[model samples]
Target: MEIISKLSILIVILFISCHSGRGNVDVQQSADSIAVCHIGAIPSRFTALHKDTLSYEKGEDNVRMVFIRGGKFKMGSTDFVDAQPVHAVEVNSFYMDEHEVTNAQFEAFVKATDYVTVAERPLDPKEFPGVDPAMLVPGSAVFTNPSKVDGMDNFLQWWQYVPGANWRYPEGPNSSIRGKEDHPVTQLAYEDAEAYAKWAGKRLPTEAEWEYAAKAGNHTSETYYWGSEKKENGKWLANIFQGDFPMKNTKEDGFETTSPVKSFPANAYGLYDMEGNVWEWCSDFYRPDYYMQSPKSNPKGPSSSHDPQEPGLVKRVQRGGSFLCNDEYCERYKAGSRGKGEVNSPTNNVGFRCVKDI
Candidate 1:
């Protein structure tokens, strides 16, 4: 309901795109027209192919996972202030989803449990003391970029709350996910993600587990999961915005919004969509200075949450970037960069994968 004021300041300005009423159609066309040379599938010779590594599938959902061997690696980054103090962290072997959860998978869970996402529920009057009861309608934040804008200070210019906007109707009541079941499910609040994870007998990854898995045990201060370079021989490795932020997307990666998971190459650990597509939910609470006191082995993130920009709200860690991320404005697609979102606020650019501890 009334999704404004529910987002963190950074999330508010993180990413936006131009909306042309039929925006999704035009963007999808642009993506389809791009002549991208696809990379070959993961090779069997990779290190993750060990016999001890586990892979599993369950139910009609058919979610697949890859075994990530535990090891010590230097986490965080020197480039961003929040990811500073590059510290050492080690995680035990765990099974991680090969791709982000898809709409088909989420639909299966919802059908089995009749689960209602937070965005689908009515807004409690007690949560907003002074707001008019008439304005408190169930809804979620949807991206709606203007054709052009003068400044970025006002986030409401690009994001709006529309009733009937949920994972099924990402853009609003008018949009549908009919042919896009393979695409990553969006408009999920933290509780929605957690609920899905629990039903699937998995849990959201810790900040440490996420970083370690992304690094794929080949950590060397690389800017991206594949390597230090954003582009490999003039090829896009992830689905990030390729043009002006909040104005245009070149669709160089064959996606205008969320791509079908694994549309691009997987990381060294055989994980897909690790760097871009959508910001993924992490189990840990958010704290800018948590790295300073993080434990050497298996750091699970801060015990409590804190964001100076929005002190009253509880925030959780959101890893990777989204299709809206561009180097010109938001360079969050780089490895070790950090993002946070209010636990109850579901935006179009956020989704999540799950992990199971061995």
Candidate 2:
């Protein structure tokens, strides 16, 4: 079935019938001479699994939305090697969160709504009884220097899996969100973000809307959300790694960790942290070649597929860049350079905002 670009709101329920499977797979050159799997393989069992149901229930409280006018713009990148073959895309008007969900907001949602984050819970033993206890620890990704590096790259050197580092405890067991309410909440999985959106009468923006908003009407191809220039008047526009990634960060932005959502200037649309801070989650399943087949109007994503590159068969899209991003490696600050992450995966540098139909 060909994926259609319609304005009608639908509840997309991802159905996993079988756990073991492989779709269209291709070997592509990744950074540091590593050939990784580029997962965009359309499955043969493609069918209308289910439509997206109502996002928000009735009578949700304390939810805010930012009105975004829809328009036509180039969706992909022409500069990045992976973001090749830019294409035109059109979308309808929608409402999105003013900023990435903050710690205060997330705490309020959990306290009032009695929501339990995925990381806080334990894995179902029936699914994988032989799972390692260490791997199943309740936690999310944390940014920490490796104890001993055996020449693996800088990006790998900085990311560590700290136990008890979920949304409540951002920096593992020892750290907490106390006194840091304004900071954008990290260590949230895609499921956690979706739950909050549903509780707040909103939904996560599709990858298309996220990119369009980042563009902010700049028809010219640019590297960052702000502009082609790296800085403005000798000032850093966004929070990124400097003075060598992983090993040494000068904290040039006056932050060793996450900064406030609006610490940097807004894009042309007045949206802050659209390029820096933390990566935002989108509703689309990542496909590097989706631009080639995506509809010119309101494109969602591929009909169905399995990304072999990921640890398992999870489908989702990650947008914007995180604080760990630098020019030396993982130059994903560009609006078009896409990062493919699993739907259930959680990391310290990954957070999400919300969106709704206008």
Candidate 3:
């Protein structure tokens, strides 16, 4: 099993804290709140939800989850509203897959249960209300060659909302997963991840638990999981876009697109790809001001929001940034960073990992 060591966890915390941009927001004071120091303060035990015990049985090359002892740690980012206040959060001990669920793992699930992802099916015309069929055309996010010609910041140029794009056809109509069994499954909706988790006797990690586990048992507030030192002690820790945004990947990390899980070193918690590889789905509704109203212990976000951005008020938090993220455009690859997308919107850059009660 892959374990993100306690040391790496500390590095992530410290690095992220330092990297968090300066904030003018008021720091909420807590009567009993203590500045994070002892790593043992975080909770590390959990009640198993599945009766079937999970063990590391060597298989084809999929990385398995490592049990992490949960404890208290600061959740949210110091800079972004999505990660505000850096409050204390405690998660029960849970088992998290070392890497994001890969194409191989998703394939096994499909073969075993004949599961079909939502993106693989067409959207009901009625679901769109008055939308045209052309607009309703089935599609998923695809990486574009930004330099081939034109605008780079916008993802639409390359991430065409293709009509037949799904996990099987990641690049769209003509593309298929034919030879990439080891790649992390993409274009997975939140429900898709939930389905796979159910089949595996696991569930998606809550935002707090996910962040805490990503931190491992580290006590410092360093940026990035590896520490304050850039380039992973003079080496890159995970796969991220290099060169200019959208175009010119340069494969600096040796990957133009997604890399296999654990292609980088695990954080202190022994969790792999916690910072990059793919954007993971978290089980929480995304509210920009959530952290401000969040509880200091085991926050679960708001029951509802008054924000007009979401008409139906439907959105979920995505963590660990994806291969598509770059310093030029998307910086969500950091541990404390975050992004949001519709629960039903599946993209080639979006994927997920699972968690289970210890």
Candidate 4:
């Protein structure tokens, strides 16, 4: 419900839902959420995707997927509740996209299949009993800077549903991705990512695989992707929020919102933006307690999903962090930290990459 004004959804679809079908949408206060968001469908022109993401060179469409040799490492973090128990997890070697999927690459898939994303569709009025049908237009949650702040408890201060705010028109229908084709596609639901994965001959990585990949085959267990400090040589190492949350961004990483896929350096596995940029989707269904019983070898997460907050909907795991993450608010940019969202929800900051069996 998080984007459409569900009263129950913060548009988690911003994925900030208002209140409607799945009721009592609580303020999502976490490292994963920038303000509050929801998934929405906002259609764009066909020619939009064909723009040159290759400005990054190597044709972002052909950007090489990295080969990650797998092994065991501590899978969860000590601080977060869901990531606790620090279990040992081993995964098989796999091929992972060196970076998140870009707008240009997604355009190719859309062009090839004429596929439509969830946010591009209209809302089913059956889901909302008392709301005006006219309000249920295609849209997604977007982070708007609040003019003033009484407190951070209410995400509605910055997150809202913007009609026609799909991946192409990230901010809304009037916005354009013309020069930002190289940025990871946003406003995508898990199903959208899955559809794209199927078309691309790949699949989303399992949570174990994703964590292992982020760890880059156990390069370090320090929890920090690049060790203790957030900066390397006095320069920011990854793309994360460096100022006040939902209000101000210092743009310390040379980016205010989403940046080009390879704008930051890669990990030990030759993977770029694994720690920050945008939250990448993982294949596993999310269960906060899954780690307690997770298998030691190639764990595939829980059989079903559960989130006490949004108990009515199923949620999938999202990893890495967005530009909204910072020590002041979201610290999910830390390695092994986890994010979860309603399965159908998409947001401006939430995007995904893919992986495959080797």
Question: Tens-digit lDDT track for model 1 on 121-181?
Answer: 7655665467566666666677665798767645555666667788999988899888999
Task: Give candidate 3's root-mean-square deviation (CA, Å).
Answer: 12.3
Considering summed lDDT, which 10 consecutive residues are worst modelled in model 4?
16-25
Q: Indicate the worst ten consecutive residues by lDDT in candidate 2.
A: 2-11
Tens-place lDDT digits, model 4, residues 1-358: 3434453252332232311111122323223333232333222211223222212211124658898887878888765656777888788899999999999999987776667777777666666567677777777777778868888667667777778878889899888889998999998888788877776777899978888887865545675776778888888888887777667777878998899988877878899888878888888987767887898999988889776655656678888878777765667667777777666667888899988898
Worst 10 residues of 3 by lDDT: 36-45
- The TM-score values for the models, in the order shown, are 0.83, 0.81, 0.78, 0.85
lDDT of 3: 0.63
**Backbone atom clashes (below 3 Å) for every candidate:** 0, 6, 36, 46
Shift of residue 144 alpha carbon in model 1, Å? 1.7
Please identify which of the two predictions, 1 or 3, would achieve the higher lDDT against the true structure. 1
* lDDT, candidates in the order shown: 0.72, 0.65, 0.63, 0.72
TM-score of 3: 0.78
* Model 3 regions more than 4 Å off: 1-63, 128-136, 148-154, 305-313
* CA lDDT, candidate 2, residue 238: 87
Model 2 C-alpha lDDT per residue in residues 108-218, reported as the tens digit of each score: 877765666655665443443454443444555566755455553233344544557688788788988888888899877667788777777778888889988888788
> Rank order by TM-score, top first?
4, 1, 2, 3
Candidate 2, 305: how far from true, in Å? 4.0
The TM-score obtained by model 1 is 0.83
Answer with 3 or 4, whichever has the higher lDDT: 4
